[model samples]
Target: MPTSQPTPWGRARGAALGLVLVTVTAGALLGGCQQGQQRQQQGETRRQEQALQAAATAQRRDLDALVERCQAGQAELVTAAAALSAAEAALAGLEQRRYSPLPRPPAPDPAVLQRYSISDQELELERHQQALQAWEQEERGRRSRWREEQRQERQRLQARLQRQRQALSAANPAVLSPAPEAKLNREALAAFRSCKRETLASLGS
Candidate 1:
């Protein structure tokens, strides 16, 4: 029987060895594929982390800028509050003194004098003083036709008064009472007073 086929045990051992080799080779191939897939996953995870970190950095910068603006706004509010308080205090102080000024006195009449005596010589002196003032005011710096009109008016009054004095001197005391002379003198005095007022007012009294 062909040497009993070299004992079937030997064939069995060879088959077993072949099976073990195939199994080990398959295990090594699977392990290598798993390792490659793991490396790919790790690379993708790293890329995702980097993208997240970049986005977080941008958001942090934006938050920092917003915080800075809020701080600046708070400082401005403090300044405005101080200014408003100062203005309110000033208004309050002014309100306290709003009604404390003294009342004004009445206007004085032009004919009244601050002196003690009344005489014709003194009155004539006052009239001459007024005429001198009018002349000085007209000559200082500049003049107009209005000043000439005032001068002419004063001259006419003076002439009329001179004529009245001559008439009084020539009149007889029995024929004419002094009443008419007194009336004429009063009228002339009133006209002279009005002329002084007009002159002073025209010169920005």
Candidate 2:
């Protein structure tokens, strides 16, 4: 009779304990799974970030050279344009001069009918002047074309430089990493120190 009286309370306590144990076990398993997943994701992020950095570093020297060449081309283009303008102005001035009319020479002697000899010299001079003007114009056109081509080349180089820089930034670990920029900055500092030490060692040897 006494055992029967306590049966309901004992059964209730066992059921409550079993439920608590099952819940705790499930929570611990779930925590483990979450931690594993987090670690896996972090490893993947690290791999991706490392690949991007390597790619950027590999291209750095080439990109720097391209930027330098582009700047030089831009300077050359500026000088060429100035020279072209000066040449064009001189050409315009020469073209504006009026063509001289043929000059009449003195009438031949009337004593004996003599043929009037045309001054072929004047015609030759005129022809030379025309040819010189044509050459100047052609030279100006060629210079202008060269200037345009240089400008286009400079623009293409600039665009390529910008694209390379943009790609480098996009692939930056600071952008992709879960760590803050400040931490990445510290890492960079450490890397720089290591590189400097290595360089010094090589030089000393």
Candidate 3:
């Protein structure tokens, strides 16, 4: 018996089906690759965005810290300046009083002293002694008061300077050296001391 051969149409149908399966498989693989690439891109973009947000947060924190320091420094400066002015005023008053002390009693005329009787002379001597004692007492009290005031003013100035130093220390330690405001505060402290010394010398003179 002769075997029947496959029809041409049947072979063509088989070829077409095979081609359709190959194309579908290729499309599926290409879609998977594209999806993977998109996922990778998305991940990379997320990382970049996170990095930017972190940097911005850090920058804002630094700026806030700087502003706070500046404000604190300004407040300290104003307080110190007011203290300095008060110290200066006190020194001025002390100096004025020191330079112009109580007036001395005038010397009695020699003729008048001789003309007076012995009893009268004794009474005059007693009165002169009393006046001298009173003057001395007044001078001592004034000097004591002046010394006390000077001591108090010096303490105030020193305390203010100490506060300024503390403030400077509290500021950004990341900065290697003193800032301009700190330098200015130091200069002010020096000037205050110099003024105190000069005023004391003037008082002494």
Separately for all candidates shown, the number of backbone clashes (residues 3 or more apart, or on different chains) is: 0, 0, 0
- Report how far residue 84 has shifted in candidate 2, in Å: 3.4
Model 3 weakest 10-residue run by lDDT = 168-177
Model 2 C-alpha lDDT per residue in residues 1-205, reported as the tens digit of each score? 4454647889899999999999999999999999999999999999999999998786665555544543444444334334434544544554464433333333334442233235554555566667767766777777677667666755665555444333333333221124222122334323323334343233223
TM-score of each: 0.33, 0.34, 0.37
User: Which residue ranges in model 3 land beyond 4 Å of their true spot?
Assistant: 1-3, 75-205
What ranking of all candidate models by lDDT puts the best one first?
A: 3, 2, 1
RMSD of each: 37.2, 18.4, 17.4
Global CA lDDT of candidate 3, please?
0.63
Clashing pairs in 2: none
Estimate, for each residue in 61-104, the C-alpha lDDT of model 1 and write its tens digit. Answer: 75555445434444443343344345445445544542222322
lDDT against the true structure, per candidate, is 0.52, 0.52, 0.63
lDDT of 1: 0.52
Off by over 4 Å in 2: 1-6, 68-79, 87-205
Candidate 2's displacement at residue 65, Å, is 1.6
